[model samples]
Target: MDFENFLKKLKEKDRVTLSKVITLVDNETKEGVEFLKKFYKERKDSFRIGITGPPGVGKSTLLNKLIERFAKKYDSVSVVAVDPSSPFTGGAILGDRLRMENIYKFDNVYMRSVASRGSLGGLSSSTENILQVLEIFGTDVIFVETVGVGQSELDVMEITDLVIVTLVPESGDSIQAMKAGIMEIGDIFVINKSDREDAYRVSEYVKSILQMKYQDKELTPPVINVSAKNDTNIDELVSRIENLKEIFIQKGIIERKREIRRKKEVREILRDMFIKSIDRELKIIENKNDKDVSPYEISEKILKNIDFKSLEDIWKER
Candidate 1:
C-alpha cells in the first residue's frame, strides 16, 4: 500500500498495517524513511516512559500492572518491550507479550516486542524511529522497556520523558547500582518484590544515595516499594509518575530535553552515514595492494575523500 493510505490506516488504528509499518521502519527501508518524513511532523505530542533494570527484577510484571493503570487514564497506550538478541538468529525471544497476556484483550493497548539487535543500552537500532511511528499512530502514551542489560540501559533516557528503574531486593548494594549506571538514569526508582527481607534495606540504600546526589536540587527522585505479583503500591507508582510529569512541565525541562534528543538523533544519523561511506572506501583499499601503506595512511585517504564541507552544510541545514 501507498504511504498515504498506510498512514490513514494507522490513524484508523488498523493493527495489521501498523505492524507492517513498524517492521518496515525497523528494517530502515526507503519506504520507511519516506513514511517518517511525511507523517512525523504531524506528531507533536505523546508521553514516553522508559522502564529498565537488571534481569529477573520483575520489570515486565511491574510494567503490566502500570499499563493497566495507564490504560484507564489515557486514550491510547503502547509498549515497546526490548529483548536480548539470540546469538544464532539475531532475533529476540519476544517473551514480554506472554508476560502481559492479560492485557491483550484491550484494544487501546498496543504491545510490541523488539530485539536489542546488538545495540547497547538495551534498545534496538530502530527504537528511536519507531517512537515517531507510534506518535503517528495516535498513541497518547508509550512505554519503552529495555532488555535489562546493566549499564547499557542508560540509552532509554534519551527517548523517554520519565525513566523508571526497577530493582528487586536481590539486585545488590547501592554502590553496585551506582557503578552499573542505574543510579544516574532513574527518574523514579521502584523496588519490586517488596516482600523480600532485603527490600527495605535496598530502598534505604537508594534513598541515601539520592539524597547525596540531589542535595542541592529542588526535585529529588523518589524510590518506592512495590510487589507487582500482589498488585501492591501500583496505585502509588501511578500517582508518582503523574506527579513527576507535572514537576517536569513546571520546571520546563521537557522541551529542553526534546531539543537535546533531536540534536543527538541528527548526530547519530550523520555518524551512520559516515561509517557506511568509510566502509565502502575501505572495501576498495582491501581489494588493492594497500597493505604496504600504514593503517594511518589509509585512514587519511578515507578522510580526504569525505566531503567535509558538504557534511557541514547538511548539518547546518537540518
Candidate 2:
C-alpha cells in the first residue's frame, strides 16, 4: 500500500497496518525511511519507560501489571519487548508475549516483540526507529522491556525517559557488584516477588546503596518491593512512576534526555552512512586487486578521497 493510505488506516487504528509499518521500520526499508521522515515530524509525545534487569527477574510480569494499570488511564499504551536472538538462526522465541498474555485482551494496548539481533547492549539496532513509529501511532505511554542484560549492557538509558531496574531477593550481591554500572542508571528500583523470604532485606540493601550514591543529589531513586505474581503493591509502583514523571518534567530532565538522544541518533546515522560509503569504495579497490598495498594504506587512500562537504550536503537533502 501507499504511504498515505497506510497512514490513513493507521489513524483509523488498524492493527494490521500498524504491524506492517513497524515491520517496515524495523527492517529499515527505503519506504520505511521515507515514512519515518514524514511521521517523525508529526509524531505526538509519549512517555517512554524502560524496564531492564538480569535474566529471570520477573521483568515481564511486572511490566504486564504496569501495562494493565496504564491502559486504564491512558488512551493508548504500547510495549516493545526485546528478546534474545539465536546466534545460529537469527530468530527469537519472543516468549515475553506468552507471559503477558492478559494484555492481549485490551484493545487500546499494542505490543511488539523484537529480537535483540546479537546486540551486546540488549537493544535492537532499529529499536529507536520503531519507537518513533509507535509515538506517531498516538500512544500516550510506551514501555520498553529489554532482554536480560549484564552490567555493561545499558543502551536503554540513552533512549528512555525513566529507567526501572527490577530485581529479586537473590539480587542483593549482584547489586553490590553492579553498583557502578546498571545500578547507577536506574531512576527507580523494584524488588519483584516480594512475597519471598528476605525481600525486605534486599530492598533495604538497595535503598542503602542509593542513599550513599545519591546523598549529595536532590533526588534519590526510590526502591519499592512488590509481588507481581500476586498483584501486590502495583498501585504504589504506578503512583511512584507517575510522581517521578511529574518530577522529571518539572526538573527539565526529560527534555535534556531527549536532546542527548537526538544528538546520539544523528551521530549513529552519520556513522552508518559513512560505513556504507567506505564499503562502496572498498569494493572498487578490491576489483583492482592491489596486492602491493596494505589494508591500512588503502584505508588511508579512501579517507583522503572522501568529501566531507558532500556528506553534509547529503544530510541536508535528507
Q: Residues 1-318, candidate 1, lDDT per residue (tens digit)?
A: 488899889889898998999998898877887899788786847899999887788889998998888888888999998887876777556788767854685779998888878675468778998889999998999999985566456689988888999988887554474544778888999999999898889898888888888864647889999999999999999999999999898888888889999999989887876765566567778898867889998888778787776655544443
Candidate 2 Cα outliers beyond 4 Å, as residue runs: 148-152, 216-218, 285-295, 307-318
Using all chains and alpha carbons, the TM-scores for the candidates as numbered come to 0.92, 0.92
Best by lDDT: 2
Cα TM-score of candidate 2: 0.92
- Number of clashing pairs, model 2? 0
Candidate 2's error at 18, in angstroms? 0.9
Residue 192, candidate 2: Cα error in Å is 0.7
